[model samples]
Target: MKQRPFARLRAPRSLAAMATAGVMALALTACGGTTKDSASNSGSGDAGSGASASANPNAPIKEGLKIAFLPKQINNPYSTIVDKSGIDAAKEYKGEAKEVGPSDASASSQVSYINTLIQQRQDAILVAANDPNAVCGPLKQARSRGIKVIAYDSDTNPDCRDIFINQASSEEVGRSQVKLLSELMDGKGEFAVLSATANATNQNTWIKFMQEELKKPEYSGMKLVKIAYGDDDDQKSFQQTQGLLQAYPNLKGIIAPTTVGIAAAARYISGSKYKGKVVVTGLGTPNQMRQFIKDGTVTKFQLWNPKDLGYLSSYAAAALASGQITGAQGETLKAGRLGERTIGANGEIVLGPPFTFEKSNIDEFDF
Candidate 1:
């Protein structure tokens, strides 16, 4: 029997003020890591350099494939929702999906999980890496054992994984964050970034683009005072938001690129003196940011549907495990209901551009 595409696939959309003219061509860089098997070590190199890269396309897709999802941290609301989407996708594919990871978002936390997955002989491992370089060693070992390694949301070094599912264009997300904050602040005043963690690959990449975007003449009046780390912790983000307010008396706004950080910052501002004075904007789900937007604590924010991100990642993992496509440039995979996705440069598949959720359209989204 022919299989239909994965269920609950939705068309990707762009928000009114969020679409950009062009995507910046950002070069992929190699991250550092040491592996046990130095002879077959996969750290950073061309496609087909690793054992998984050379996996045969005709190889049987493991039945009831065990796919382990390792997010940065367990029990995180955002991670929980996204990982659930992956698990649902696994069920649709007749595969088993399990969630495993550290409770805290730290650079080295995911190493143990990867080692455990290797011991269990899982077919594929889907991860949103906490640190790009930290997980490469264990991931390389997993690949050596013919395990399909795919990174999603947050990515590891290109050499460590077969493919990476990017939630959105990093450059676009970073620029849009600055654009949204600049608009809210009327193109001027001090702003700070409340990021997830210092070593987070995606967070650092977006922050880099934000800094680049700030150099434009239109944003000359805008100043970035500080970039704080919340480690994707609710309390840490809340306290960081408070610290920003205390440290920068004239701060006009904050851009928290992580879902956790943004939500926590909003919660802080909603109950604090900074409410209505300091605008909060960044990546957050509609349900989490809905009240903040309705109460005027936050005017706008951006995010791709994380559930969809996980869904796509799951399909991609299945495709790889099934040996339908290699992680090569120009290779295409049938992404269930989301339609076909082509591999871009550096074995990356971009889900789509992010959507800005404002009060007008925030209610239209639930995830």
Candidate 2:
């Protein structure tokens, strides 16, 4: 009497045999189900498959995409760090990053790279432009072709590029350098500025801002005697600094906004008879200006970490590529470990304020 539930309803001899076969056939049919619904229910499903694939443009665009980071020059340490940080950022996204730039910071050379990136169909170009508007035409072409253009360290025209990654605000850099120079000179002296090429975007901006700030009553005693261009060349900067000394015999301080100019001036002052009489300061790096600082030729200088600039630039580029940001003014972005910063009106992201370095803390930073 311990019969199975369906076993009690035994079929007629032939019908029972047919029912058993029918049940077996149904079981097999269920196991070998080929319905669209079944296919969707299995491992290889169609649930949102088409929509998901089509919704993400960057997912496909990012695969095997290449980004180029073109600096003003390949030889300079500052640009070298830019190149390195970009490569590191690309590695995280499984992308390709390469460096292409002139060895001498020529505008024509940078233009060539812009053209090359366009021809290669690069995904994005992050450049530290040699001259503003010089590479605009090619960068505009890149934009038309769906390639994103970003400027880091220095910027091109806003209409030509998607974003500019500024190491710090132009005014902050200018004021910080002026303050450093004033501190080094004890708040009163005739000082000359050794800037980069006259057309250089960053150097000119900072110099102008510094000149305006020095006119304030708090800095009225400090006289900015002259603004000279060194073209960012070592020999030229050295000669320019020396020329400033000759041109202004009473010059008590020198502010070289260009790293090359600043370091060259420091070296020149250190090797000359005016070593202790004149203090050299500006945007030189810790490694390059360390000896001069130790020797007392450069008592103080101001700069944001160059590596941080590179790191932030790469992160911003990634954000743009991933469609996380559009480089719009007032948009805020987190530059890696450095906190959030709102994009400026110029489509630039300012890294933050610059810090002055003197004997007390110059030794703590390596570059």
Candidate 3:
């Protein structure tokens, strides 16, 4: 017998509704032969004309459009799940979807993959940038070759990508983590952050917001002891967790906003004397954190459905590739099952709020 976690105030709407409602109708008016002008440009379509002036002007209105997803690293559990969901969405639209990226989360590793996708003439390239500026050059080249560039999960520079599919509001996520940690620590004592790579755009943004949240009077007794980077590696994060305990014997809690870092920290604490002594909480999938919660190592954690994030990103990419939306602020487009989404400032599309998972309900979710 398993218990369901209590519903948090920020819980997203039923994902079951999106999965069961089925895929949206594919608009086929944009199909058939490519215009000679578009075909003449090195087998890829012309950036200025084909991308902006297709007959349907909304895609993927046609079949055979190739969309590629580049995660920060290959074989990562979180990235694999998210990219596979995107592939499923592409198939629903009768288009081909490919996942390609380096094995490690290096800043420059994604650049070569972007260039390869451009040469392959992919219609769209969706990326989770390892570093914001490192991949901008290659992504700009992809755009020049008529490939619609969209950032998902993690973002590149604004000038490099046409749109960004953000998983959740960074400010909200940061504040929520602090709120959870405060409750676990009794609103006082010292805590540390176990983060991903130091240069990760999303991690840094969320950390900045967490720093701001700490300024509130309620959290004044909650001192931030240190910030440690694990490079999103399991072994490194475990070591960092051990180091945190050794350095700050009075540390009362740890907030790890990255999936990899949080899980690693939990694993370390679960097997050590720190278990029950230090509270661990942050963003994590239920499947990954279930045992931790059951063992009293982690009280709670929060995250949006990664599958839905990928699904929305896939549709957003196809919409741009088919010219349905131009990534403008205030432009709106429909995403299959998830409903209509608007392009917010900085060409961003928010999926929704993160949900809290605990022993009462961690068993209810599989992703």
Highest lDDT: which candidate?
A: 1
What local lDDT score does residue 253 receive in model 2, on the 0 to 100 scale? 91
Q: Candidate 3: where is the Cα deviation over 4 Å?
A: 1-60
Order the numbered candidates by lDDT, best leading.
1, 3, 2
Cα deviation of 162 in candidate 3 (Å)? 0.5
Better of 1 and 3 by lDDT: 1
Stretches of model 2 off by over 4 angstroms after superposition:
1-63, 339-341
Per-residue lDDT tens digits of candidate 2, residues 1-367? Answer: 1112121112233211111101110010112212123222211221211111222223322446578888877767666654675666667667777777776766666887677666666667898877887988877766655566789888887777878888888888888788777767889989999987777788878988898888878887899889998877899999998899999999999888878888999889998999999988888677778888887888777777665676677767766666556676666665545556677886778776676667766655554
lDDT per model, in order?
A: 0.82, 0.70, 0.80
Model 1 ranges off by over 4 Å: 1-62
- lDDT (tens digit, per residue) of candidate 3 on 1-367: 2223322222334444222222222222223333223443332322322244433334445577798889888767788778888888888888898788887787898887777777777788999988999998877777766678899999888888888999989898888889889988989999999998888999999999999999999998999999999888888999999999999999999999989999999999999998999999999887789899999999988988888888899988888877787787887888877778888998899888778888877766666
What is the C-alpha lDDT profile of model 1 across 253-290, one tens digit per residue?
A: 99999989999999999998889999899998777888
Better of 1 and 2 by TM-score: 1
Q: What is the lDDT of residue 126 in candidate 1?
A: 93
The TM-score of predicted model 1 comes to 0.86
Candidate 1, residue 24: how far the Cα is off, in Å: 36
